[model samples]
Target: MIRSERNPAGDPSGPTHERVFRALRTRIMHGEIIPGQAMTIRGIALEFNVSMTPAREAVRRLTAEGALSMSKTGR
Candidate 1:
């Protein structure tokens, strides 16, 4: 289980991108998103009710951390 001491929605301690990152990371780690599943920045932004920039940042961070892989086609 992913534990957070702060309430992401109400906490002002972290940036919006960090909140999105933690949420997505937890979902991925918990098997909420299956392997080889299709995901997009637009989809993530919509799901998290955040802007594309934060969504992109979260995706980029996840990719860099080896939690996700991006193909040449940017899938």
Candidate 2:
């Protein structure tokens, strides 16, 4: 039951990661991100200001949905 100022977006519903993942998913599904866009964990991490873990999970979920294709070389 602790209140914090971390929610500058005024979204008191939940954490920011979920919103980021949703945006990421939409972008990927709509061809905004593009396949073979060379998205690194660090790049995504930086892009969304999320740690490697959540970013990784988001990517994994996207991969599972077949919206994103992962290659061996990360290219």
Candidate 3:
């Protein structure tokens, strides 16, 4: 989801990675993310308007938390 500048969810007042992580985590827990859905770090970065670093970190964290499952192909 593209965070809009006028949206409160896009507060832009904290660490980018944390914000991205929280947003994604909430989605996962709330069943917004479907089973077997796949996305790339690059796609995350682009969608969230963040740099690769933050997006990678967020994905890594979610993977570690079991909120996201990584495939052998690293999807």
> What TM-score does candidate 1 get on C-alpha atoms?
0.79
Supply candidate 3's per-residue lDDT for 52: 83
Report the backbone clash tally of model 3.
0
What are the lDDT figures for the candidates, one per model?
0.81, 0.70, 0.83
For candidate 1, the lDDT comes to: 0.81
Task: Please say which candidate is ahead in lDDT: 2 or 3.
Answer: 3
Error of 3 at 16 (Å): 0.4
Determine the C-alpha RMSD for candidate 2 after optimal superposition of all C-alphas. Answer: 3.9
**RMSD to truth, every model:** 6.5, 3.9, 5.1
Ranking by lDDT: 3, 1, 2
User: What tens-digit string does per-residue lDDT give for candidate 2 at 23-47?
Assistant: 8888876889976788886788788
Can you write out model 3's per-residue Cα lDDT over 1-75, one digit (the tens) per residue? Answer: 766433435575677888889989999889998879998889988998877888889999999988888888878
lDDT of 1 by residue, 1-75 (tens): 533333445667587788889998999999998788888888998997777888889899999998888777666
Candidate 2 weakest lDDT stretch, 10 residues: 1-10
Local error of candidate 3 at residue 54 (angstroms): 0.4
